[model samples]
Target: MSGAAGGALAGKRVMVPETRELEVLARMLERHGAEALRCPLVAIIDAPDPAPIEAWLRRFIATPPDDLILLTGEGLSRLQGVAQRAGIEDGFLAALRGVRRIVRGPKPQARLRAVGLGADLSAAEPTTAGVIETLRAEDLHGRRVGVQLYPDNPNAALLDFLRGAGAMPDPILPYAYASKEDDARVLAMLEDMAAGRVDLAVFTSTPQVRRLSQLAVPDRLRAALAATRIAAVGPVVGQALEAAGARVAVMPEDSFHMKPMVNAILAAIGTPGSGEAA
Candidate 1:
């Protein structure tokens, strides 16, 4: 079959969850003839003080720590820029000279490799739960660890989880929020959804769900989300949608990638699938 025949998102009205992933996804949507809407729920920024992070790198000059955590691809990308701004480019490279980096998953690992940093380890799953599980198995209780945080500035849940799991190593957030930027299309997308102009909405991140709560979308627009067909790529995104009062229309098995998820949603819209209460 051709791409359009195999792609579920073909000609469907869709919503993008975050600005970071929008351009590429939007292009993909268009290639499939889908009318994609842009609505970024959160902004991602460089961490504060490129200096300390650079300094953090110095300690790794020789044999970098046995392990480091790469939480998000966005975080990893920002860290590189943060290092450059702090004039610690050389130090940053030295610190990671040969140390093994444990990224959240394939995407983050891909980012590392893109920057010439090879992955030491990558979590089996894409969620925080997967990261913790991998860390636990590696016995991080006493090892000093580095972490890249999420854009929303979530309260160090990973740190707490590590400590609770008997980890005593220092977990530093090196960079704080400096790369923050909201997706400009959020409100318009919401309006479209509210106007019943959208047939499907796709989400890759949960922050999009949280950010909508912060938007000034009228109650009617919010109600529109509840009535529209929604599809989340994974459990976390689905949970966030449900919490926001929008039921999930489809979450496919195994294929968490955006294109596949949309395909699954379209398949289900025409066939029977697991749909949450609206």
Candidate 2:
């Protein structure tokens, strides 16, 4: 895992906009001989109030939904954490088991498996549209679908799609994002991007793109990003960058994760056939 030997990303300066996995990602990049600039623009935390989540769990325990959709593994873990705090861990797990489960991606699927549960349906692509398209193939007429959501993104399209297909949609948002506007370090990072000091910019979530735009000024950020090699973790993140008018130059070919994304970044920088930096 050491980059003392020859590595594809040797001596590259890479910008990482991650919060929870900041140290892990930084270590991974450093292992590949890359100078990892750790800048987190947004911080995700459990919702200040747990009343809504508690209500959802109570209703779920009373009458489980016909289908449960998990969008993020973080949301699932957060739900369990809240349930444990409320002393309803066993009940909540039982209620979840009563209904069919659907996962948007491998992360949530892995989370379910960790809890001895499995997804009844899984999206081929790890995006909101992918979840909708995957569910469209099934018959959800008059069925109740409970959706687990993460911070910042509401994913209204999925709910609209479910309603259009004659299914009732219930959303449970367990987390919320608080901007790191007060952090002086973020301003320095923005200045670095503006000066083209960062060689490559890596994004794991759409909110990271929004946070950068908010802090760096969208037009200025867009201009600065033009010269930077932007690497999105997956299509959803790529779309977010593209929507913000940033050119996304790299993404994973198959699985969407930190290691795969690092390899994708290496490939984009002319190091084709490079494996995980770890």
lDDT values for all models: 0.65, 0.84
Instruction: State every prediction's TM-score relative to the real structure.
Output: 0.78, 0.93
Q: Write the per-residue lDDT of candidate 2 for residues 1-278, one digit (tens) a residue.
A: 33434556776778888888888887877776678887876787889999999999888888899999999998999899889999999999999988999999989999999999999899978888889888889999999989997777778888889999999998999988887546567767766776888888889988888877677667776777886789989998898899888888898987888888887776677355556566
Which sections of candidate 2 miss by over 4 Å? 1-6, 181-183, 270-274
Candidate 2 residue pairs in clash (backbone atoms < 3 Å): none
Candidate 1 local accuracy as lDDT? 0.65
**What is the lDDT for 269 in model 2?**
76
lDDT of 1 by residue, 159-258 (tens): 8976686654344454333212343565666777888888878778777677676664547546868757888888778887787878888886764666
For model 2, what is the error of residue 42's alpha carbon versus the real structure, in angstroms, after optimal superposition? Answer: 1.7
